[model samples]
Target chain A: QQQVKQSPQSLIVQKGGIPIINCAYENTAFDYFPWYQQFPGKGPALLIAIRPDVSEKKEGRFTISFNKSAKQFSLHIMDSQPGDSATYFCAASRFNAGGTSYGKLTFGQGTILTVHP
Target chain B: EADIYQTPRYLVIGTGKKITLECSQTMGHDKMYWYQQDPGMELHLIHYSYGVNSTEKGDLSSESTVSRIRTEHFPLTLESARPSHTSQYLCASRGGNNEQFFGPGTRLTVL
Candidate 1:
């Protein structure tokens, strides 16, 4: 079973617009949620992350709105630009007390985002 | 940027050949993972290690084997490569935080 599900496999938006990518997870134990951005020929880079304790977290032009009750989270890009065109992935992980499963991320299906100039 | 490295950024091999993909990290992280990713698909965990001398299979069943002989190095070996094994392999390591840092993936192709 896919632990995490993401919608809109691909997205297209104009420069200066706002683009949103959403994700939902099945595991209630998941406590950490993070977003990654990947450009072609490069590895995914951590963009921003949030914990269930907070409703939202923002870093510069990127924001993550998280709803604990719904088990849903979304990434919002403000003033989307051509440079922001890349594949975005949402991932979730539970806090392992034993530290064995620590950092074991369950990733959602990625979304290819394109910001047109 | 994370100081992680993957060797042979691209590899093309014949079927039945034995191959090893190399992953190393300077961050000295205790957790390392191997993930397989295909175009337009989600990343699948194939193998992971908690620290030196410890390795475990991931959610996905894979024919490949991994070894963590050194804290900074983890290598994955395939006894026999198959066309079906063609995919991109990604290496990641995590520090004290929950986030994982990924290396440039190695694209493998088997003919």
Candidate 2:
């Protein structure tokens, strides 16, 4: 079972447009949700994150929207630029039985985004 | 950037050979994990270490083994390489609050 599900295996958007990627989870136990961005031949990097208590978080051109009741969340890239073209992954995790989450992430398959200038 | 490193970024070896992938972090994080991934797929956790001399298996059943002799280094070993083992392996370390630092990864090809 895919504990976390992400949509739009690939996305194409115009520069200056807003591109949104969505993700949903089956497990309500998950309390932390994070997004990662990966470039060619590089490891995934933390972009932004949010918790169940918060509905939205913004940092620069990136924002994360969370819906706890729906068990869903999304990443929104404002004023999308060519530099934002990369693979994005959504992940969720719960503090394991011992309350040690340790960032053992359960990730989505990933969404590849391409922005045209 | 997180100070995680992986050696031999790419490896190609014949079957029946023994291979070890090295991973290290200078960030002084106590939690480390190894994940196996195929092209364009979700990563599968294979092994992890909570600290020096502490190790555990992950959700995926893998034939590889890992060791954590020092807090700075974690390495994975495959006793005998097989074609099925060809894939990308990712190493990650976590500090407080479950934020992980990841390495560039090692791509292994077995023939």
Please name the candidate that would achieve the greatest lDDT relative to the true structure: 1
Candidate 1 C-alpha lDDT tens digits along B6-84: 9989999999999999999998898999999997578999999999999999989999999999999999999999999
Cα lDDT of model 1 by residue, A1-117, tens digit: 339999779999999999999999988888889999999888899999999989999999999999999989999999999999999999998755355675689999999999999
Which pairs clash in the backbone of model 2?
none
List candidate 1 stretches off by more than 4 Å. A96-100
True contacts kept of each: 0.74, 0.60
Residue-wise C-alpha lDDT for candidate 2, range B1-111, written one tens digit per residue: 579999889999999999999999999998999999887677889999989998999879999999999999999999999999999999999877778788999999999
Model 1 reproduces a share of the real contacts of: 0.74
**How many clashes does the backbone of model 2 have?**
0
All candidates: TM-score = 0.97, 0.95
Candidate 2 residue runs with Cα over 4 Å from true position? A95-103
Q: What TM-score, to 2 decimals, does candidate 1 have?
A: 0.97
Residue A94 displacement in candidate 2 (angstroms): 2.0
